[model samples]
Target: MDLNKKIRVFVVDDSMVFRNFLIKSIGQSPRFEVIGHAINAFDAERQIPQLKPDVVTLDIEMPGMTGPDFLRKFLPKYPVPVILVSSLNLRVFDALEVGAVDFVRKPDVKDEITSKQFVSTLLPKLLIASNSRVRMPRGTVSSAPATTMEARQLQTPTPRTMEHFAGENKIVAIGASTGGTEAILDVVRNFPANMPGVVITQHMPAGFTAMYAERLNKILKMEVREAKNGDKVRQGLMLIAPGGYQMRLVKRGTEYFVSCTIEEKVNGHAPSVDVLFNSVAQNARDQAIGVILTGMGSDGAAGLLRMRKNGAFTIGQDKETCVVYGMPMEAYKIGAVCQQAPLLTIPSIIYRQLGLLTK
Candidate 1:
């Protein structure tokens, strides 16, 4: 951890070609140094301890010992920040849940344009991973069982109660980055299927958001899918903003829908939280609920403030529960958050704010 020493990195991939490419690309940066590499988890397991690298870039699919398995074994012992480099797949999320810090999609090595694009996306993530906090994997975790909207209605206050607050028109907007994958799942899984429509913007590359949406749909009773250009925003459905694009809320008559389109990066990210929150500020106004979760930077702070100024109810995840407190901290500092809550409490807070519960 010397300030003068460049961050040392260890690369692990099954492909020798990719390992070399990564070493060359990462080594070019004066801030980083490629110390060593291994072909798979076994090789990495043997060499990593001796190298004592600051960061490790890993591959998801390998000849033996998949990335998630490696993480489950390695993190508990060594506790070094690890970044997964792979093609877009659901297993990437599984790895993140197990404890990998972040991920970068594998580029087409034969294509010059894609190779350059890959480096652009990777270098920053490498820097972020190096400084990220590594957490120990837990043995047991509990999640709320998925229930149908009707079943949820039977347990909570009736729709009659929510009708008084114009809850039918309410929309929830959530944004996150860095440690977002697990944090988002924790909040969303606790939601009842009858809750208001939710829109999420989690910083991720293209090709992975679809799988993320698919994964969420399997676990939550509500319909979940990657947002399309004109998908309707409605109760019992959650729209995750597609990666590599920007998603904004638009009103048609009395109904709300999302407009997902390719656009320049806002606040240093595509599918940015700022873009989504600003749209809610302009379109949904007081009918919107804005929640900013864990992340590395201030991407959503300004937009959350705008939402608050526009009379939207805003919440930020408390620092104690956040994996990285950057986004929520920034929002809280600017008076954007009307309330701050722990990760497990956020869903209930949203329901209460919508007048769905007496508590």
Candidate 2:
């Protein structure tokens, strides 16, 4: 835990080629050292005790035991920060729910662009995971609810229609990173299928946003999809800004839509929350609701402040419910947040603001 010491990393994957690639790529960085490599969970379980790595990069589809299974078994006994290296699939979220810190989409080794993208994404995540406090799986924490409000709300189907809010052209803009996958899900899933249109920017690498959106669509009543260039922003639909691209809200005539473009990293993140929030400030103004969730940086703080100055309602997740408390804390400090609440209460709070429910 010495601040001066290089972060020691353990790489776990089934492919020998990938293991070597990771070792070589990580070796090039002065900040990280690949202390050990494992082909599967069994190998990792044995070597982890001796190697005592500062961080672990895991593969989800390994033979014998999958990544999620390993986390359920290992974290309780030997709590260590785990970063999942996965394909564009739902398994990554499953791993996060079980206690992995974050994930990077697996790069296609044959493609040069993808390989470079992998390195750009992996390096920062390793650093973040190294400094993070790993928590026990939600299932193990008996004091808190195992299932989020979204899941329970879905069970008793509410047939609320969007007809009443037809005149309110409001949009919700959300931003998150670090532990945001589950945090955002907890908020979005509770939203009624007929709620106002929503847009999100989650700090994720290329090829993962589509899958993440698809996963949310399956559980939530609302239609969720990865934002496309010139996609119309409409009620009951949630557009996730595609990873590696910047999404901005633009008004055409009386209607609003998003313009997705590849741009330089803003505040050290592409698909940056700042980019999305600033756009909302310019376009939606007082008609928008901005929410800053758990993350690791100040990317959205200034943008949230801009939105508030422009008269948009803003909310920040309370530190007690946040996995990192960095982004929301920064927003709160800068007077960007109009209200702060725990994760579970966010959806209801949004509904109250929109007049969907009596406060």
Q: Who wins the lDDT comparison? A: 2
Mark the regions of model 1 whose C-alpha exceeds 4 Å error after superposition. Answer: 1-3, 138-166
lDDT score for residue 346 of model 1: 78
RMSD per candidate (Å) reads 5.4, 3.7
Tens-place lDDT per residue, model 1, 246-323, is 999999998999999999999889989999999999999999999999888999999999999999999999886677
Please state the error at residue 71 of candidate 1 in Å: 0.8
Clash count list over all predictions? 0, 0
**lDDT of candidate 2?**
0.88
Positional deviation of residue 246's Cα in model 2 after best superposition, in angstroms: 1.4
TM-score of 2: 0.88
* Candidate 2 lDDT by residue in tens digits, 1-359: 57678999999999998889989999999889999999999999999989999999999999999999999999988999999998877789889988899998888887889899799889988998887768677667445554664354434322345566742589899999999988888788767777778999999877789888988999998899999999999888999999889999999887899999989999988899999999999999999999999889899999999999999999999887777879999999999999998787787778777877643
* Residue 272 Cα positional deviation in candidate 1, in Å, after optimal superposition: 1.3
Off by over 4 Å in 2: 108-117, 141-162
